[model samples]
Target chain A: MSQRSAGPELLRLIELMARLPGFGPRSARRAVLFLLKRKDQMLLPLADALRDAGEKIDRCEICGNFDTVQPCAVCQADGRDDGVICVVEDVPDLWALERGGSFRGRYHVLGGVLSAIDGIGPDDLHIGPLVGRVEAGGIREVILALNATVDGQTTAHYVADMLEGTGVEVTRLAHGVPVGGELDHLDDGTLAAALRSRRDVKR
Target chain B: MSQRSAGPELLRLIELMARLPGFGPRSARRAVLFLLKRKDQMLLPLADALRDAGEKIDRCEICGNFDTVQPCAVCQADGRDDGVICVVEDVPDLWALERGGSFRGRYHVLGGVLSAIDGIGPDDLHIGPLVGRVEAGGIREVILALNATVDGQTTAHYVADMLEGTGVEVTRLAHGVPVGGELDHLDDGTLAAALRSRRDVKR
Candidate 1:
């Protein structure tokens, strides 16, 4: 953390690396040293990657997902169901859902939920654009795959209300014990919701 | 982890980011998204920093410490004790010792310790340059401020032996329980060394 110990450029590299989501000063220094040690193999390639990403990547105009393409590969893909749209809070959630591979529909990224404390309103998100996509039309359903947090729920409810008269059926991800999750570790609210929404088993 | 979900450039960025010391696949994706979000502020600066460090930084010819200068800032500093050289296993250790602010001497970076399993020998390190420095004269002492690991101790012994007939006094960092460390949490070897090398209190 003492800047004078290492050179200014090296110190600056560590400082910027520390700004990464999970990196602290110590881990940043370690990462910088790691990069320094593997200059040709790792450092140069990483730098090139960063620069290339910076220059090439942009938010998808249709879904708000970041990609090199304007509409994004997801949006550009012809195999997905255009009749259904899955609304998510951020790109990570979109990626997670895609990884699950169950949903065949396209996605609409909200960028973030409506947080009054942080002064985020509907305008701050991609809500208007979502409504426009639904209004313009072939979408039969819009699934709100937002987090179950207060801000997320509020945003979902607001979006559902806005799209009420648009003829599209607004739905949400189910509230239940996650698959492979233990009942003992489940919270009371989730357990109660799961019990209330229990499905009948078919032979 | 799904390469096709995010575009090629973004995927490549995440792949390179995953190679960083502490980042895994998930965290690398998060870090990449974080950079994407703060394109002008964080991403560009980090890219610039990496490129600058890659282009400008080089190992000091005399000490092997990485810096923008050929001799490095430490080797060029006029106030430090030129008569003493603190030998370390790597640049991180050199930085750590410098951060302590107790060592007024210059340093010699060994790059790495001799590891039989890794096939690292004496030639792989900067031991030859160190001996050359001592042989050139004016150096009164050489402190082996290496780690307490087996390889570190082995390297220290090897270095001591190499500098045996050169008329330079050789020493090592003291082996003891670290300051502010609890005795109960200390290892038996450290405790034994501390006990055997106990210093008398003035009071």
Candidate 2:
């Protein structure tokens, strides 16, 4: 292979980029070269930003979102409708809903849905804390924005069952999402349509 | 628009990722969350790798290729045949040829071709240095591995004309490549075919 002309620092950057989802060695090289060409405009700023973020940020204590503070701005917001908490399987889903600008509430991330075959159980999820939040607070609605996976539905049903006598309104994001599709993959129109058509889940 | 549930660090990562070539906020958030969840396995290592790379590498002083050293390993290597120098417009082209496991000689990167419309003249390139190298050494062949663009052809001819009396063989890559196609986009097989079918340019 033609050796990289850059020093250890650039080589490290290319290696890290290669580990990203779709970047291969060729693309990684191109990307690194491009960044180097625009070092003043892109590379140095990106480096400083990443380093600063890495050194300063932490996970939100209340809902598991990213934030500079302990509970995150969303969880700590005074005006947010805390009575309605949206529960999602991943951070992307929460971002999607927030982008719609329709929901003005807080969030609860399960990290991932329960997958028995994958050895992911209830304890592995944030389900316990969700139940605790519902029981301890003045929660009126718990919007389940989980994916339309078999596992997602299973976890949703499990949560709904657990909170049955707690007299809380439990609903799921509507159908129309393709099977095994991720919330992040859906277009804004499709996501909005799904949200608009949401149906309640009865235990 | 979706509020980050994790922390500012995660949000910052997602924001930074969204600015990358093909990623959007949604995908960025998903990627950041995935990296975070797999921090020990992916995120932390990636972050460390980025930091290390940003701190170590530099451009090769001789050929403008990314390198850790000034002259770089390519320029310092005595094993590379000095008789035939393959001249390319960029380092990526050199790397592409190298990936095919062919070509055993050293290289001269012109950085870019002569584009009068873009105000890129011979003086703006490393052509003068290349000529000096050819004149000062026992160089026999100068293979022009520049793109097949009109500008590339013009630059190649100019270089050939400048080195005429030096008794050095000046050759251009074959026209097997279609017009307007970038060498970077061509496959190894196509590139190999082109190289094997290289034609001599009549002055």
Best by DockQ: 1
State which candidate has the highest TM-score. Answer: 1
Query: By TM-score, how accurate is candidate 2?
Result: 0.78
lDDT of 1 by residue, A1-203 (tens): 35555678998999999999999988998899899888899888888989999999999999998888878889988889999999999999999998888888899999999998999998999999999999998999999999999999999999999999999999999999898999999999999999998998882
Model 2: CA > 4 A from native? A2-11, A116-119, A176-203, B2-16, B22-26, B38-41, B114-124, B149-154, B174-203
lDDT, model 2: 0.76
lDDT of each: 0.91, 0.76
Q: What 10-residue stretch in candidate 2 chain B is worst by lDDT?
A: B2-11
State the iRMSD of every prediction, in order shown: 1.4, 3.2
For model 2 the local lDDT of residue A34 reads: 72
